[model samples]
Target: MNTAKSTLVACCQLAPKIGDLAYNRSLTERAIRSAALRGAQVVVLPELVQSGYLFADRNEALALAETRDGPTLRLWQALARELNLVVVGGFCEHLGGDDLANSAALIDAQGVRAVYRKAHLWDAEKEIFTAGSEAPPVIETVHGRIGMLICYDLEFPEWVRLPALAGADLLCAPVNWPDGPRPQTERPAEVLRVQANASVNRLFIAACDRYGHERGVGWVQGSVIVDADGYPVAGPAEQGGEQILLATLNLAEARNKRISERNDLHRDRRPHLYGMDSSLD
Candidate 1:
């Protein structure tokens, strides 16, 4: 466990409107620049950060989707190289001839590194986006080995666990969590869900989220960072403004914490006994 290396990570939590690609792009570029100026080596933005969350209808959603190698990627590549930074964010990918995929992409000092399409679609998503067939891949970078997952994927424990098992040091989640119309009491459940996920996985997690109303759709404004111990080390910006969640991510700490006695949950799991959709039961 080499506790020698550390990297600064930033999560940009901002608001963008649905179908407003130009505005969304500007928002992201500004956030990237801000993060870089703040000395963040790794900067993350919310899911569909390029094109605001358009969950209404399939046709409308697909129209806003862009290809992996499209103009959007090129722009991100240029920015990543110029800033010499790692940029992770979500987008609606246009697959052409097939249905579009809700995808997350990683861009670094080199260029577009790898992409992960959302495997688990939520509610109205099933009608607009096709479920990604490929599994998530962990890519090694200057900072550490990183993995990408879109919004709803973080809710499942195995989604984070499998990647960690494959040597993922950081899990980047680009989310567009909706804000319920109910009282503040209901929001705590969502916050606790992220904390539990981070703690159980013993992995560093960063979530960049969309805020404000888009296409009249309300969103959960807080973008947060959870440490290896499953604690909210940074965010939950409930106040009423855009902000960045900055934190020092020590890759070595993940390994040390995982092996520590404080969390035997990882070591004590019995796969044989809990096989085949056991979580469903």
Candidate 2:
């Protein structure tokens, strides 16, 4: 694929009603269209967007889970092809009988390009979903090589680093952050973590977090789009409302991960001295 000169990425913060599949789908579709109208070539939605988070039990989760070719994803695939855009978002995945996973899908004009299962489950999620065993693969696109992670997976440095090392220019993080006590600072700790990850890897990151309360559980709503240098180009959007954060970025900048003449982010790595023996086997 030819490298795109510049891409407009949008992170959509939504408030999906719990268990409202149809309503959530409509909301997501609207958000995608809105982003496309603003010239966004890449759009990301929040984790568990179609089914919503905070399920009552495993059965409830299973009820909302859908197969890879289910209605929601099919609609997204059609939209991607129609709008000529890349869509990355999270959903409850149904892998045959009684098997479910918290997964994210990357769709483009070619349809579903990749799916990333959340490797690290958070809190009660372990009880409702199967944890993924493999790391996500980097997908080549006209805009750039895109990688994906869902919710708590973003908390793990190794998970994010794997994609960067695999030549991913941007990481699309679909998150459902629970409401937590915030410091007096403007940005939430979760947003700060994303910024740190982007700066460390020298890659752009679009973290799309949901807002509002779901089944009595509140969300922090720190959806943001950060540049390759880790500065926020869009937002730490309002804590209680649905919002879309957009940023235009030169994807090639991420490939040049050098801070100065003698410092290259990937080449300067001292993995051999980091205390892990690669030759143990």
Candidate 3:
């Protein structure tokens, strides 16, 4: 009996219309159901996918934001129960009294397990969303220990470290990587960052990105599922349109953070020497 622990993870890279709450919800519903049909134990979607990115102004963003109990989350919760798969997707969070956040929810068969708000804001996001002060939440699911984060939050190694340190086997990031200039025939720098983060933590990472130009902005469409060794198992997508990338990951691999026999990834950490206002966490 080969009992190696593994799970099929899917990154549903699709475009969500700006300010079209109904359309976005329908888009995600299709993607989630499709992923579940394809044997995905976990499905991930793009950043701010509940509404869309590139809001015209605060008024526009506020109009699109949804509370946790809103229709979108309710639909996701229903799907999670019916399909019995984990869903990690981003949304424009309405944090009562006009405050908004770039948030992602982790849901399983039981219900909405956790909601992580984006801590690091990107360009225009600083103007519209309130940055979350809370650290990323790691929840134990039937598949494995799962952690959640949104786009720019993945850029901060310290932030990613928190979940890994807390014993998360996999990290799901919902991203909307705007198209940017890079060298010809080279991978997107954003994709490279996901690989780097996974390797450092020896944790599996699934980052789902969006496509379709939104309000004059094009996206990278670099959805990917990387293994603990930092290599792409599914995709850094072809950069065309929408795509569904899937990979089966050995969740047990993350438990052994050994690159070399003597060098353990977490055990060899020199954090105390890295200068901080520490009571030595």
Candidate 4:
């Protein structure tokens, strides 16, 4: 409970091959162990890491998903307990009755603590994955009060704002962004968007993105760890190879940055003005 002590978090970026659950899980476990060895209290992996993004059809995608407490989760739970580490990662979830969700799980030293289905699906996600009705949960762990977001969720400022409003000090992301096959100029904008979110919110943002080539889609490599100041501590801005970026955070400092009454975005929000935007179909 010493907010003054620094917290260490790791971003585990990978180029997970699509449809390779076993391989991806193994890779994840390895990353977790490696991060723990490096003294990270929490390790974050990219979204849908278990299954390489095979978005060819709904049936194919659903076939590869599982419940939050299914076999895959059990494995992660065991690993988390054994390593005494907290993990946040993305996965394709089978909620039941033929429904599917693009979800993120927060597993701590004890077990899977929370599951957040992506609420705002982007592009093809709208067609394949069901959007979650609930908001992002701010989870309190041995690490800190953490906010969880996945991939495109970072594109929306509101996605990060809600958790910060709920007293989150750290924001963890698990992403699988494909290379638009464009030049570098096009990619920095996306990266800057995430950094801007971190800076404006005054919260540490740890983003782990999938790298390498999969299903003919290349990735914009970089698994980044941005401080509360909205600056990357380490990792690539371009495509990341399998790697880990480690950084320490003091949430107490982040909490102080937004303390002013006048500049408090968390307290100054006008809900009446916000409902119009939320009502969009």
Using lDDT as the measure, the top candidate is 3
- Model 4, position 97, has a per-residue lDDT of 86
lDDT of 3: 0.92
Instruction: Name the regions of candidate 4 deviating beyond 4 angstroms.
Output: 181-187, 259-262, 268-281
Better of 1 and 2 by lDDT: 2
Model 1 spans with C-alpha error above 4 angstroms: 181-187, 257-264, 276-281
> What's the CA RMSD for each of the models?
2.9, 1.9, 1.6, 3.0
lDDT of 1 by residue, 1-281 (tens): 34688888999988877788888888888888998899999988888887777667887887788998876677788889998989998888998875888998999988888989999998888888888867677888888888888888877777767777666778888888887665755544556677777777677888877777766677777677888877877876654457888988786666644444564656656765768355532
Clashing pairs for model 4 are 18-52, 19-52, 221-238, 221-239, 221-240, 222-240
Query: What tens digits encode model 4's per-residue C-alpha lDDT throughout 144-246?
Result: 7888988888898977787877778888888877767456455465577778888877888888888777667777776788877778886644664778888
Local error of candidate 2 at residue 195 (angstroms): 0.5
Clashing pairs in 1: 199-230
**Candidate 4 lDDT score relative to the true structure:** 0.81
Q: How close is every model to the real structure, measured as TM-score?
A: 0.91, 0.96, 0.97, 0.91
Error of 2 at 181 (Å): 0.8
Global fold similarity of model 4 (TM-score) = 0.91
- On the 0 to 100 scale, the lDDT of residue 36 in model 3 is 94
For model 2, residues 1-281, the per-residue Cα lDDT tens digits are 33458889999999898899999999999999999999999999999998999999999999999988999999999999999999999999998879999999999999999999999999999899999987877999989899999878888987888899899999999999987776766678898899999999999999999987777888888899899889999888847489888998888889988999999988887777876456421
Whole-model lDDT values for every prediction = 0.79, 0.90, 0.92, 0.81
Error (Å) of candidate 1 at residue 188 is 2.8
* Candidates arranged by lDDT, highest first: 3, 2, 4, 1
